[model samples]
Structure formats: C-alpha cells, structure tokens
Target: MTRPIRFGHQARPTPDDDLDGVARRAEAAGFDVFLIADHVGHGPAPMVALAAAASVTTTIRLGTYVLNADMRNPVQLAWEATTLDQLSNGRFELGLGAGHTPQEWAATGIEFTSARARKAALAERIEIIGRLLDGDSVSVDGAYHRLVDASVPRSHQSRLPILVGGNGAALLGHAGSHADIIGLQGLGRTLADGHEHSVRWTTDHLDAQLGQVRAGAGERIADIEVNVLVQVVDITADAERSLAQVAEMIDDGTTTTDLARIPYVLIGTVDEIAEKVLHCRDHWGITYFAVRALDDFAPVIDRVRQLE
Candidate 1:
C-alpha cells in the first residue's frame, strides 16, 4: 500500500530536559509521534513517561521506540500496554525488539541469552501479546513462555498497532508476517561494546532484508507499514562535509555514494532531504521515519508534507 509520509521524534530526556515540554514541542513541531526508548541505565520508564506525555499532548502519538521483549513477560506487558493505550486515548504504538545490549541484562541480573535464543523468545512474546491485547484468553505452552487463561484489558483502539524493530532475517520475517509495522535500522552485527552495530547501510543488505519482509508478508504486504530509524539527520548545504566525520566513525569501508544512498542517514538541506524521503518511499516502501531529535528533523517534516 502507498502510505502517507509520517515523522516521529525520539525523546532522550536528560536531567535538564523537561519530558512534558519535550513532548509538547514535538507535537507543535509537526511530529506524528513522540517516542521514548526502554533502557535501564537512562530515561524514564516508557509506559509511565508516555502516560505523562499523553496528559500534555492531544494529537501527537506516544510509543516506545522499542521495549526489550526479553525483559517483559507478555501478560504484564499487555496489561501495561492496555492501560497506556486507554490513558493516551488510543495513541499508543507498541514497538518491540529482541533485546540487544547485554549490559542491560547484566545490570538487572537477568541472564543475557544468545541472540538466536532472544529472537525466538521475542517471536513467542509477540504472539502472546497480540492475542492478549485482542481480548483473547490465550493459553500457550512454548519453550520460552507459558500462559494459561491469560488475557488483558482490551485496548481503547480495539486493535492497537504493534511495531516490530531490530535486525535479523528471522525476526524481520516474523515481523513482516505478524506486525502492523516493521522498523528497519539498516544495522548488522552488534559490536564489542554491545550498544553499537556494524553498519549494514549498503543497498545489497537492505534489499535482502526487504526481501525477507516481502516473503513473510506475501499477500499481507499491503497492510504493513515499514519504518526506518534514521541515525543521522544533518540539514546542511555541504552534505559530504557534514557526513565526513560520520563516515570516519563508520569504519566499514562504505563509500560516500553509499552514504548518500542509505536511507538510515539523511545529510542535505530540507528540500534535498525531503526529496530523498519521497525516493525512499517510492523505492523501498518505507513511509515512516523516526529521528533522535525534534529540532534536527522538524523542518524536513514540513518540507516532506509540502512535497507530498
């Protein structure tokens, strides 16, 4: 399906930044969604923070950029999702991922399992969470989770949107088959620190990933919306110069042309970046974009809308 272009801002609230004001500003700046990340080290709890954001904003949607599915049991997560959805007047978008960041588990004393194991667990969690949120009495005997007569309060939206995010063919394929939205970060293997990833920004890699999504979606392809998390949004006349440092940091032998082509990095003036936005939708079927900061991406939102 041809979807309308949408913009979302991820709020990384520090001690000095006011969360409510940040959300309000995101709405005023024309963001379609205001998102928070789920992390133990930083930021407020996503559900609680989004509830607070809901109280202040009337239009902007609230979402978890993604919650770590490994840490959350499906039943409790579904209940929290339902409450947040109701409180937000049905604006909640549930974003889930196979947990990355081994340190998160280490800090919490949760066993940090293998990536393959985590992905398998996430798939099961998604199944349970969806069934529960749909007001079904779910009973499952799975390897990672077991539930008997499990159900949650139905969300206000009847069918709340679920966004599945992360990198991996298995996970993305499953997301394609099941999720309302598939989030692509164009990332590869997690690096040594556990937080960063090897850049998989090349078209070849992305094509393979989308092929997986397409294969999984099959006839349901038209119903799913693809979202990209843009790592860098530089509104500048000198695109190459602006991206030079980023290129150095990448260290993946990716060329300047590759950088220009990658949807994960937007480095140009508002008009130029807006053109790229349309191109992404036309070429890759990606209609939704989320960036880290509101100010960096707000101008492109207006420009993209105007161009659209």
Candidate 2:
C-alpha cells in the first residue's frame, strides 16, 4: 500500500541543547516527527524528553526512535506510553528495539542476556505492550514476563502506533507480524565497542530482511509502514569522494555504487538526493525516512514532497 512520505528528525541532544526549542524548531522546519534515542549514557530519558517536546510543540509528532526493551518492564513501559500519548494529545509512536548495547545493560545493572534471549523477551514485551495500549486486560505467563489481568490507562488515540526497529531476521519478522511500523537501519551485529554496529546495507542483505518481513507479515504486509533510519546524509558536490569516505567507514566491502543505491545513505547533490528518496519509495515501498540532523536534511523534504 502507498503511504504518505514522512520525514522524522532524530535528535541527538546533548546537555547544552535546549529541549523545548529543538522540538519547536523541528515543527517549524516541517518535519513530521521529532524523536529521541533511549540509551543510558546518551540523551535524556526518551519518555521524559518527549513529554517536554510534546508540551511545546503543537503539530509535530513525538516518538522514541526506539526504546531498549531489555531495560524496561512491559507493564511500566505501557503505563508511561499511555501517559505520553495523552499528554501529546494522541501524537505518540512507541518505537521499540531488542537492546543491543552491552555497556547500557552493564551501566544500569540489568543483565545483558544472549541476543536470542533478548529478541524473545522483546517479542513478549511487544505483545504485552500492544495489548495494554489498546486497553485490553492482558494475562500472560511467558518466559520473559508474567502479568495477571494487567491493564494500563487507555491511550488517547484508538490505536497508538507501535514501531519495532532492528536489522535481525527474527526481529524484523516479529515486527512485521505485530507492529504498525517496521524500522530498518540496515545494521547488523554490534561491534566490540558496544555502541557501533556492522553495516548491512548491501542489496542482498536488504532483500533478505524484507523477505523476512514479508514472510511474517503474510496477508498483513500491505498494512505495515516501512521506515529506514538514514545513517548518513551528505549533500555534496563531489559525490565520489563522499561515497568513498562512507564506504571506508562502513568497511564492509560496500562500494560507492552500493552506498549511492542504498536508502540508508544519501550522498549526492540536492536534486540527486531528492530523486533517491523518490526511488526508495517506488522501489522498496519505503515512505518513512528518519535522519539524525534537521538542518542537513531540511532541504530534501520539500524537494521530495514536490516530486511525490
């Protein structure tokens, strides 16, 4: 199904950045959504920061780029989600991920389980959280969590969107089955640093990920909105130079051509980048694109919208 093209700005705010002003700026910049990351050492708490953003902005939607499921209990997460939804006047999208950073778990004193275990727990949380957001009394005796007649306050929207993000086959498939949005970053295994990730931006990898999504989505494939987190956005005059730099940084045998073709990296002139956005939507059915910088990406929004 064809969905409206949406541009989200993921704020990587430091202590000096004015939270309220950032939200207002994103809204003024014509972004569809303003999102923050959920990490122990990085930005402020996702829900709290979003609440602050929601208070100052009138139209732009507020969301977590993704909350680490391993760090949160399903019930408490659901409660916070509902509160944010009401406070935002129904403009909340809960983006979740199977936690990947080992340092985050260690810092918080939360056990960092195996990747398989974390994915399993995340699936269970998604089920529980989605049901609770819909105002259903959930009673589940699962491996990760157990709830008896647990329900949260109803959300302001009849159906608050749940966006599940990851690059793994299992996570993508589960998200396809249960989530309203599936966020793809074209990322693979976490590196030794625990913060960085190996790249999975090749055509073969992307096809495999989409195949998994389709496999799990089945008849519901058309109902899901696919989103890609643009890791790099460079509107450069010298495309070859920029592409080579990006490819070297990725260090995954990704060629300049691959970088140019992939939706996760935008490197070209304004018009060229704008065409890539259209190409992504047409070729992959990807209508939602989120980037890290607002000013850098602001120019492409109107261009892509007009092209669409």
Candidate 3:
C-alpha cells in the first residue's frame, strides 16, 4: 500500500504569521495531518497553538508530535485534550512519551527517577488518560499520580487515538497496550551507518511490546494503529544527505519521518525534495512527513501535495 503523508511542523523560529499561514496552506494542500511540537518553553503551547490552527482551517488534523504525559497532570491533560478534540472537531491525536530530559523535569519540579521507574510511571499515566477519556470517573493510587476522582466529557468523536512515543521495551509496551497509535522514535546516535539495525531492533521491540498490549487490551488490539517517525536536525537540501537521513530512519524502525525543510537547512530545490519523497516512499515505504525547521511551510507543503 502507498503510504499517506502527514506533515508535522517543528519550526522553532516559526512566527505566528507562519503558523497560521502554514495551517491555512496545509489544510488546502491535502496533507493528512499537521503536528506541532510540545516543548517546555518554546513556541506556543501545543494545545493552544493547535487550537489556533484549528480556528483558521476546517479539515487538516492537528496534534502534538509527542506530548510528555509524565509531566502533564492526567486530569488536567484529559480535559485539555478533550477540549482540543472538541475544538478540532475530533481531528486530534494525543502523542505521549516518558522523555529523558532532566532539564525539563527539573524545570517542572517533577521528581526524577531511574529510566525503569520513569517508564513504569509513564505506563500508569497512559492508563489514567485512556480511562478518563473513555468517560470513566477514575481514582487511582499509583507510583506517580494519585487521583481521587477524574473523568472527561464524552469524546466529541470516536476514541481519540492515543499516540505513544518512545523506543525502549517498556515504552513501546506502554504504547502497544494503551495507545491507538505508536510513535516509533530514533534510537541511534548518528545517521551515517544505515538505520537498518535500529529499524530491526524497533520492529522486534514492538513485537514484544505488542504481546503485552494484546494481553492488556484483550479484544481491543485490533483497533489500534501504529505510526512512526525519524527526527532530523541541521537539515540540508542535498538529496543524498537527505536520503541518507531518511534511510537511517527506515533502518532504525521508523516507517515514517520528518522531512527537514528549513529555508537554508536543505540545499536542493523543491523538485529535488519531491524526488526524495518519492524515493523514500517507493523504497522505504515511508508515508509521513513531519517537517523540521522550515520557516514558511508553503514550498514544502506544495511539494507534498504534488505527491497526492
């Protein structure tokens, strides 16, 4: 099957004008979904930014690339996510992760823990989020959160897909069980040595995680969807370089990736990017394009539309 493209934006220097402009153009362009990053102190808060993006457009799906669920209070996040779901008319995906950034945790005053503990806590948070979204009033005593009573209004749409992001065994397992969609992430240190091992490792990890998820959800496993991405930094337009980066993602286990498209980040013309997109899709079966660092996403958006 031909992979469909979902454009994600991580434009750090992206101005509000660019944000609205990109959202308007992206909606018109037919790119499947548009995602915003959820970081501590950068850009507009993802939920609010997506709310704004939703106000300007009618159809393009909006989401966080991956929201740090560990940091967000489940009760508050449930309400916030449902609110965004309502505002977006049910076009939102909630991506969650147990990130390793101590700086962010330190900033939030969130307690620090070992990697294993962190992953365990993240799993509980996922369960809480899912239950709350499903209209159950929840009271949980867990390692991380202890809520007395929490619930959300009925989802405006069908079950909002919970997109879980992370690569370790526990993280992947958390996704397989609770998340409707799994965000396969990069686990390699560099992009030069072909991402083959990483991909295979991730695929294997998911297989293991899937077992846990299947056990947890019982009959609900069939309803889940798997989504993945490979992140990029300091993009250049060179086709070989870009291809290498994308290929690395494929090798690492990401069936999809963010296309780096900053003004000077990439070296080639729009035509070259189109060629690269075709190459990635044809060979690697990559279907998603979460854009990186691009100032105005118009050029990249147009290039993506041509594929459809």
* Model 2 stretches with alpha carbons more than 4 Å out: none
Candidate 1, superposed: residue stretches over 4 Å from native: none
TM-scores of the models, in the order given: 0.98, 0.98, 0.71
Candidate 3 lDDT over 135-241, as tens digits, reads 89999988788898878887787787788767565666556667777665534322343223333333344345446555655676556554545344332456566
Q: What is the lDDT of residue 63 in candidate 1?
A: 93
Give the per-residue lDDT of model 1 (tens digit) for 52-98. Answer: 99999999999998999899889999999999999989999999998
Q: Give Cα-based local distance difference scores for all models.
A: 0.90, 0.90, 0.65
RMSD of each: 1.1, 1.0, 6.7
Residue 271 CA displacement from its true place in model 2, Å: 1.2
Error of 2 at 168 (Å): 2.1
